[model samples]
Target: MDTPNRLAAAVSPYLLAHARDPVDWHEWGDEAFAAARRRDVPILLSVGYSACHWCHVMARESFSDPATAELINRSFVAVKVDREERPDLDRIYLDAVTALTGRAGWPLTAFLTPSGEPFFGGTYFPREARHGLPAFTAVLAAVSEAWRGRRSEVAAAGAALARRLASPPPTADADPGPDALGAVYRALERDFDPVHGGFGEAPKFPPAAALEFLLRITDASDAPRAAPMVQATLAAMADGGIHDQIGGGFSRYAVDRRWLVPHFEKMLYDNALLGRLYTRAAQVTGDPGVAGVARTTLDYLVDDLGLPDGGFAASEDADSEGEEGRFYVFTWAEFLAASGDAASLAAPVLGAAPEGNFEGRIVLHRARPAEAVARDAGTDSAEVEEAVVAALEGLRALRANRVRPERDDKAVAAWNGLAIRALAESATVLGEPRYLEAAVRAARFALAELRRPDGRLLRSRRAGRGDVPAFCEDYGAVALGLFALFRADGDPAWFDQAGGLVEDMIDLFGDGTDGGFFATGRDAPSLIARPLNLSDHPTPSDNALAAEALLTLAAYTGEARYGERAAAVFRVAGRLFEGAPTAVAHLAGILAVALAPARELAVVGPAGHPTTAALLAVAEESFRPDLFVAWGDGHCDGGIPLLQGRVALEGRPTAYLCRGHTCTGPTMDAAELRRLLTRRFRLSDGERRVGP
Candidate 1:
């Protein structure tokens, strides 16, 4: 057996997985760079996450081979980094690769100078030459030769790339107006796959931020394409194979445009974002079917990903038992045996074939809607639904007995924050107390485990150890989550913690002169460049999320500084929003919020009073993205400006609606409050199309 490398003591599961490889792998840090300098060799930086299938493939193909390992060890200082744990480095180098090549992805392989400047890189080199790509060893040999023979050229190239990366992104001081939103809608319409219900072509990822922006479109007439696009995509995904039929969550992305075949890794952030989207969709459409999907998705978070510490896991691996999708797919015989008599009735609806739809196994998807299935089978829709549910339950039970996929049990602060907000909002929207309870527990866990003595958040926690200093995104996301919890349960502690986090976020990551937050904090380890994350990727950018949280805090406290800071962030992000609105959809949505008329609603009543419930229900019934709600009992104390001097009228529950300095209401009647909200929010009465 090969002896373990330096990765044996690492906190990341991705690093630990490579411990027994033949290559002498070093954890990403100054140590590896120093060693490279001493050895007069280039640094081979391998960046990937634990759940990446191609990362695993590259490991087994080359890193595990003794000859290949020997070549790498002799020629370079091999450093392995978990991208999730070190996203700043990943962003810097991935940007380098995209600039050098045309695209980039996981199993990111970059060759850098001893001082840590990326010179050349590409993703996932094959062990041997195949499919028009050079072999991994051949590439390594060539890079080694270039370092030795073409020393001056390599050094110059590295220097040039470093300078390019260190430069700041484009900026526009102009504020985004309604025109920005209109332009984004047009772009999305042009890319919308009307038939398959996604943007662009094959290999579609879920457009979480885009869907969110679409949902916030207030004027349906201005952006007619928004509603149909969101509805079609959500409905398609809910019925597609990418959405696990037996398990209640989504895979990373679909390999095909139709959402039929997924990549199979389940990410916590994806489910959190999608679950919250579906929940909002339910509110907009008033469709029980959409609500059901939301419930199941949120349930999956707690049941499958929830850790013993009340924090959620980062991801579930794509591969299990040495094969990708082995844990998820089933052969015809196995499906039949597990599903029993229901197989005959369920197979057609589930798109299951005797020959199988994927690798001689069935990846369950809804081939037809229940109504259509009932029409074909000569039965009622309810009966068909009942049979399908029963069959799926049986299949789920059977699959539970199989070897489960390895989970990356690290609980990342940013992802956990996403989960916390999703659950908190869903609990109120879906009327599920358990979801609220789960959210509170997760929020508490994050506060207790992922914070320093100074109240700064850590990047992640694994096995009760959190060693990494928090990034801008961590602070932003957690602050947002805590604020959501406060709104859900009216907890003063949550509000206080959230406010402090926002302050820390500004102090640690805010670039005062640049008018935006940096991806890394001031205290974080130095990198080649300090990138400003301003566009939405798999998660919202740090700047966008922080700006959002700041804006919300400003609204509640009536503080000008917070709003000014958010405006500054918008100025920096403006060019990106205008140039590629779809890429910065989250920023666009937040911009919309900033531009929209600010209306504050404060409800004053006892916590469990029926009148208070009625008043709160009326306010929550419709989507009010522009309106901020501050609810409290008559005698509550939290120092919230919005809640100050709010009291029930005539010893009954009351609501106060304010716009800027103008204040109205103190009405005890729920109907009166509904009317006020209806006018303020422009509540729609017809079939809900889109626009929160």
Candidate 2:
């Protein structure tokens, strides 16, 4: 019962759990390496994030044991890294581990030389070797003996590993056309689960970025293949247990092929990205189901996760009172007690039998359509839906009284920026002013609390602490959010703030010599090698997003510099697409914008100009990711390529459609504006030039 002495003093909860161990523990930094060199011992590097379940298991079983800790402390300079805090470190090390061992996961246990070159690595070694893997203690003893006695062999192996890690295989770009996009789609199709949505088998993650890429490709080319892939995936996710039926958001992912069992963690980034996708999907397909999911996700943020200052909280833990999925899973008896007659009606449709998905606890799901449930109950579908809602409301109240999962209330600037953008976009699509207001408030809070005195943004703030230096993602994402705010509201100040951040990002994070931006700023901690991860994770990489942000800023501000910067970043990483196209979807979206004709609509008139409103409505209704809309007033600059010299016609609100510097005649009617906007996509370029 005594506090573990090893990591008890550590700030990270995961590290604290191993505090009382016999092993000597060192927080990741220069001090750890210095001590290793002084003691003439090899280094043991452990990498993992806070919410990782197996990471906790490994810590409890091995790191906290006195015998194990003693061995580790004596032979190795044991270091612990919170991967979330230092993803650049994690990236290089993970790549090293994967290369050395041919596999990777967290709590990543890797053996490294004094200079920090990994020679051996694996994930989740048992306290005692079992399951066709070496026991942690035996592996430790063998490695330690080898380090002391077989120094030459260890050094040679370390040298080879270091070389391999240093030199990644080349990604050539011999062909650069739609074929590259086709290659990604082919990969997705190969791994696609036809019965359920998403790629691969069990433990399916929401591929929001990849799906968004497909959606954009389909919309641009009118490709039917991509559309169905997207629709099927979205539909499966919405209907599955991965979606919280009682709550408003999605779990981290489904643990099974059917999307019936989830890992139970709810991440802020997942909800933000998924919300935006659903909103856009609804716009594209006019599917009310997609709209419902989007609305519910936004509501969850506003009602449960929104911070007092307007920024959203980071995550909700998967474990509730030391048990995973405890807050969500329920027994049949518990459901019956809570639902009364409603349970009888819903039970048959939900497959709520005595034996359930997880040891008699049924994770609620809809096995049949609402109409089928309605038919079985001899009621209207609407009535059945209302009854189901009422039952869920009651169940939610009961569940609230039970023990809840610990909420991670840290406000991350990058994630909050994502939430802000999603909210603003959702507000516009769903016609909800409160969502817009929430977005504006969060943006204001971020600007106030997340910014340093010198105007550089901070990455995160928690427990009244607010000085973590912001990375590229924070600056780029917030800038994107600010641009979204500018579009949602006709405020030029938001645009100004966004533009300022873009300048700050370039000044601080730009690799002036090579081109693309670095994940860490010039003043941030130095790693073995500065890495640029363009692949999308739960969120897009900072570099890919930076390109997108720059392109968007260019569209809105009429700044050619922004466009040039975006193009340069894309070109710098152009070769990377040959091997890792999935990571560069954000860049791909930006490229699509570049290849297409840039369309900017300028509505010049009063704030409530009816004609302006009509044109604005038309712009909103149409799903054009590339289109930028702005209201033109005397205070607002009209020199933007699409707005300059665009005068109001006959004292009425007028819209100007401009490509490059040339503008068409001002139109006051919504029909005329739609015609102008759709003309290019509807007709061949040659035909359009001939005025057919």
Q: Which residue pairs in candidate 1 have backbone atoms (N, alpha carbon, C) closer than 3 angstroms, thus clashing?
A: none
Encode model 2's per-residue lDDT on 1-692: one tens digit a residue: 25454456554445554566666778777888899899999999988765676776787788878888888878899988766555667778887888878888788888888888777888899988788988999989988998999988888887887776655234343323455555566666667778887888887888898788777666544344677888999998888888888887998888898888888878888999998999988988899889999999888887777988778888777777777789998887888888777776666556566788875688877666768888977887887676677668777888989887766677889989999999998898889899999999999999998888888788887655655588898888899898888877767778789878999899888877656787788888766556666666658888777988888777765778888787667667667566766667666656655656677777887777677777888888856876887777534553444455666777788888765445687788899898888776332343211111
TM-score of 2: 0.91
lDDT at 102, model 2: 86
> Which candidate wins on TM-score?
1
lDDT of 1 by residue, 518-635 (tens): 9998988788899888878789999889988999898888888999999889888778766887888888788777777677888888999999888888877877777778788878
Q: What ranges in model 2 sit over 4 Å off? A: 1-24, 167-175, 220-222, 376-379, 638-651, 681-692
> What lDDT does the true structure give each of the candidates?
0.87, 0.77
